[model samples]
Target: MNKKAIWAIIGLMSAAVIGVVVLQMDLIRTAVKVNEERFEKNVFAALNTVVRRLEAEENREVFQHSINGFVTAYYEEHDNTGEGKPEFTLDYSGEDGRPMLSPKLSHSSLLDELMAEFANPCTCSQCMARKDNTYRSLMVYFQQNTREFPLEQRIKLQHINGVLKQELGNRGIDTDFNYGVFSREKKSFIIVDGHYVVEDAQPKEILPGYRNIYNSRYKVDLFPEDMPSPGLLMIHFPARTSFVWRSLWLNFLGSIFFTTIILFSFAYTIHVIFRQKKLSEMKTDFIN
Candidate 1:
């Protein structure tokens, strides 16, 4: 083959190799992007689940406290010892004169009635006004009695940590994470990583070691129903980027290995072709 044809073949092969490498790199980039997106989605979902569970737990505690208080008050008002049957009762007579049945007005019955009323409040003007007042009073009582507890007392660090770990693990994310509970009322992080932070530092200053905690966009309100300023539950994974890339490392290495092999093979083939052409020229000259 002439030098021009040999050079042309070399250029074509080089271009083909370059194109293959570009396509491979693009494929690796696309895979990395998809992995990162999936990781982010799972993290967000886990955070949401943790927030909901925390809210539910707090609500349950508050309602349980209120129910206990209501029961205590009912017994005290009825002048009955809690050990015996309730003294409050009402008599009813049948028109056929069979026998009169006595209905007991226990605290349980009263609670049932309240629940029924709450589920279906009367819409009449007078009834609505009364119901509104009752609702306000009940809410006030709950706030004063249950919701007024300090943030640390309201939620335990172990519980928060455990819930986060469980939820994240459930979604196949087992990375090391840092978390902080930012109190909107206090305008600072009240708790971080199973410890109460009493330094009163701003959330941005709380986790100096893990700067990503404050910068993280993965946060949810601690209790959305809490009026005005529900606290924030923030989470950050230090190894998130590495974790996302972990699954693609094999593919990346494989691409590099194969591309290197192809380039090596092309260079060897070109060298052989040139050497064979030179040997043929020498043979022809010797024969002539």
Candidate 2:
């Protein structure tokens, strides 16, 4: 082939290969993204399943009604201040008892112990102290509109934590996660702080020297659509930037290998074309 034809062929081949590589890369990225999203949803689904069971648990209502009865009675009795909190709620201290304050009961009070077993539990980054009443009680305000049941039952903590631990163990999913239940009607106030990280089955750590992308936040509504949602459930899963990087490295190496072959072939073709042109020139000079 002549030089011009050789160049044209190289151009066309490079363009085709580039197009295919770009398309393939795009497809690969899209596939990874979809899988990541699905994986997150599955995690949420598993957690949600646990929560639903807890919510529907027969004893759950038993506990909620108990809290309701306790708080309602306290509110009715303590409403000497015409504008105290209409709803019965337990907050960190008398501080949370603002204008709408209800009866402030200590965690260890006889009534609190007899009824809700309120105790100020120790607080931590990973978990809330249910005993200390740090967990707010918003059940009284949006009682009708909310789909939430009381999380004041201390036993429910183990149940909730157990679900997460069970799922991590069963699925063999290596992920560090923290989950929280938030009330939308209550201005996104947390109904149950489910931020416990299962220590034994911690998620695979991000590979060193790789960016940590495990800070992704995902929220899935607890209540079903067309139904009133008292709150939402949110989970944070550490991103697998290391795993993603491994895949990217392979892709980069593959692209380099492929492009190297095409470039070598194109160079050889050009060399041949130039040699042929030189041979033709020699023949013409001999005839002249």
Candidate 3:
């Protein structure tokens, strides 16, 4: 009913507005962070699914090369770095003493060739043009790890040799594959004996994005538990903007929600002040 009361209400409303604005920012940050985290976690999970599948499968050479081609192209298109990349590796020594298969290989003469092959043969007919040339003397090494509970060493070694031998044999050329299991005690790598031949019937592609249509089956359930395991490709998750955005978004959303409440409170205060003023005027008329 008094001027002081009206001014007090106005001040409170003003403070409410300011509070709402400040809190809104925090809400928005919170919401965005939470959403982004969920997104990133989902993406990481999808990637992990691929990793697990590759690891679980006995043979991974073809799949590794195919995925490498796809991922390399995908990252290049987005201008993203292959930081904390998964351990899917391609090491190949060409005739020129250069590692031709891995994109990370220094002195990559086959970059153009690889890109062309992957884009053309791997891509659809209407996709893009690609060159075709099977480079000779290219040695590729493919490795993946399998970890099952109730640890068995022999079985692990058998898996390592079997996958490698089968893959190499399917490619139609025989090569000696050196398998050394890493050790902390011996400080030496042991040799795995086997001559592998890639057959003509079940041909394996050494190039990226090439497919292998093999139907031969090998018995893998009889290996001993003391066999040495092969090295695995590492998958790392680096600090990314996705992580930061996820954190910020959660805070932002929280701020926004609080801000909205503050605004509503301010509006209600303003309405009450006007109603009180109208009542005061009516009381004055009655007195008059």
Candidate 4:
């Protein structure tokens, strides 16, 4: 083997290595991309589930408050004696043949009608979902106090974050997550944080409320513009970017070992060929 042939082999091997490296890099990128897309899809679905549940819960709370108010009002008018619980009878002789509590005020009738309207009936797929008003209206009759409760309730930041953590678990997303609520009205500040966080999710300039947790590209809007304190819900996934590398670490190591062996054996073969050619040339010169 001459020097020229040796140099040519080295060039060919280098080109082959570079080509394989380029291809491998692209393949890794593609795999990561596909994984990310699937992750986002799952996150979106999970978010939809949570939003639906929130809506249903809000309706239920409203209905309960309404019935409580109605019952308290009715008792104030009817209760002449300071009795613990009042006993009342309803007549079922109305046009609808339904039980009626004193047709004079017809307040009970209105309550019954409201209960009937909100009652869950359908067994279909859509009805079974949280979007459907599948819960029967809860009725409580005869309460002492008639005071109205506050219109707005503070959102539980911790509970919501915990639910999101559970949501990811149920969907088999193993990566860490963090949530932050941002408000533009209060001088563009973060008022609250969902406590599900990891160390990597923190931004360099620490905000007022949020802690560094998981970092992800998924951001959801919580309560939107309907609430008195409207804000944006940010969900982060810190480990998502390195998932492919972690999962395929063994395969990458094996590839490196295999490549090293192949290159070393090739180099040894070239060395042996050069030595034999040198010995043959010296023998020919001595015989001549």
Give lDDT tens digits, candidate 3, residues 1-288.
688978887887798688768666666657766765665454444334433443445333433454556667755654665444322223434443333344453223334444454455445432332122222222122222222322223224555556554543443223232332322222222222322222233333322211110111111211111244332211222333444464466556666676677778778878888898899899999999
> What does the lDDT read for residue 253 in candidate 2?
70
| Candidate 1 displacement at residue 73 in angstroms | 1.5
Best by TM-score: 1
Give the per-residue Cα lDDT of candidate 4 at 240: 68
Give TM-scores for every candidate, taking all chains together and pairing residue i with residue i. Answer: 0.76, 0.47, 0.29, 0.60
Candidate 2 lDDT? 0.52
lDDT of 4 at 221: 56
Candidate 4 per-residue C-alpha lDDT over 195-219 given as tens digits, one digit per residue, 9 for 90 to 100: 3223233445444334342233565
TM-score of structure candidate 1: 0.76
Clashes of each: 0, 12, 48, 7
* Ranked candidates, highest lDDT first: 1, 4, 2, 3
Candidate achieving higher TM-score, 1 or 4: 1
Off by over 4 Å in 1: 80-147, 201-207, 284-288
